[model samples]
Target: PGMGEAQAVPYLMGHVPEGVTAGTHYLQAISTGAVFMGAVTYIGNAPNFMVKAIAEEGGVPMPSFFGYMLRFSIPFLVVNFIILSLIFF
Candidate 1:
């Protein structure tokens, strides 16, 4: 279950290009970014799919995987990410 820190951290450390820190802050930043970016796709988060399933079963029409991205995530979340990047970087 601890795949991220156990396996991923080692693999990422080994593959990191020369001059890259691969330090605690960098790892934390990437981990946090991964969490935030997960919202970009339904499959990226398990509860998203579960909630979608529950809603559909209750007679709600949920968007398809790509439909959700194109209709909502790209327009809303991606724009916010762009703005955040501009401000932060």
Candidate 2:
């Protein structure tokens, strides 16, 4: 769940669930999760760190890790993922 999508896609591709097609819905769901996972943690993706640094340099007061998780990831990203699951998977 934490790994970046570029590296995690292989895991999804390799560990296909029983009865699930490798190239269809299952793969799509896994790919979506992997991509969305970047928003879950500050270190979860490279661009996040870069963006955080840029924001800080520009005088933005960023949240702590856990604060970010609770305020941003949990409230917004997770909800969006749930919606994605309901609509697509």
Candidate 3:
């Protein structure tokens, strides 16, 4: 949850399906993960940090990491992901 596709591509590349070649399937896997999972946490993408910086600069109180997790991420994203996976995947 603390990365973007630029940082996550390598791991996705390494975990490609056994039969999949280094072309369409490989790219698809990386892209899909980047799109869906990228929103799971504040550090999951570049914009998150930018937003935090801007908010703090503007004097808006931002949630701490653990607080964000407990108050928002886990309660919303994780549960929604589980339900979505069960229904779709």
lDDT, model 1, position 75: 96
Q: Could you give candidate 1's per-residue lDDT for residues 40-85 as a string of tens digits?
A: 8998899999999999999999999889999999999888877865
Task: Tell me the whole-model lDDT of each prediction, alpha carbons only.
Answer: 0.83, 0.88, 0.78
Q: How close is candidate 2 to the true structure, as a TM-score?
A: 0.69
- Candidate 2 residue pairs in clash (backbone atoms < 3 Å): none
**Which stretches of model 1 miss by more than 4 angstroms?**
1-29
Worst 10 residues of 2 by lDDT: 17-26
Stretch of 10 with least lDDT, candidate 3:
24-33
Candidate 1 weakest lDDT stretch, 10 residues? 20-29
lDDT of 2 by residue, 1-89 (tens): 58997988888878876787547877798899998887799999988889989999999999888989999999999999999899988
Q: Write the per-residue lDDT of candidate 3 for residues 1-89, one digit (tens) a residue.
A: 68897979988878887876657665765665576577777888889889989999999999986887789888888787768656654
- Between candidates 1 and 3, the lDDT winner: 1
RMSD of each: 6.9, 8.6, 9.6
What's the alpha carbon RMSD for model 3?
A: 9.6
Q: On lDDT, who's better, 2 or 3?
A: 2
Displacement of residue 11 (Cα, Å) in model 2 is 22
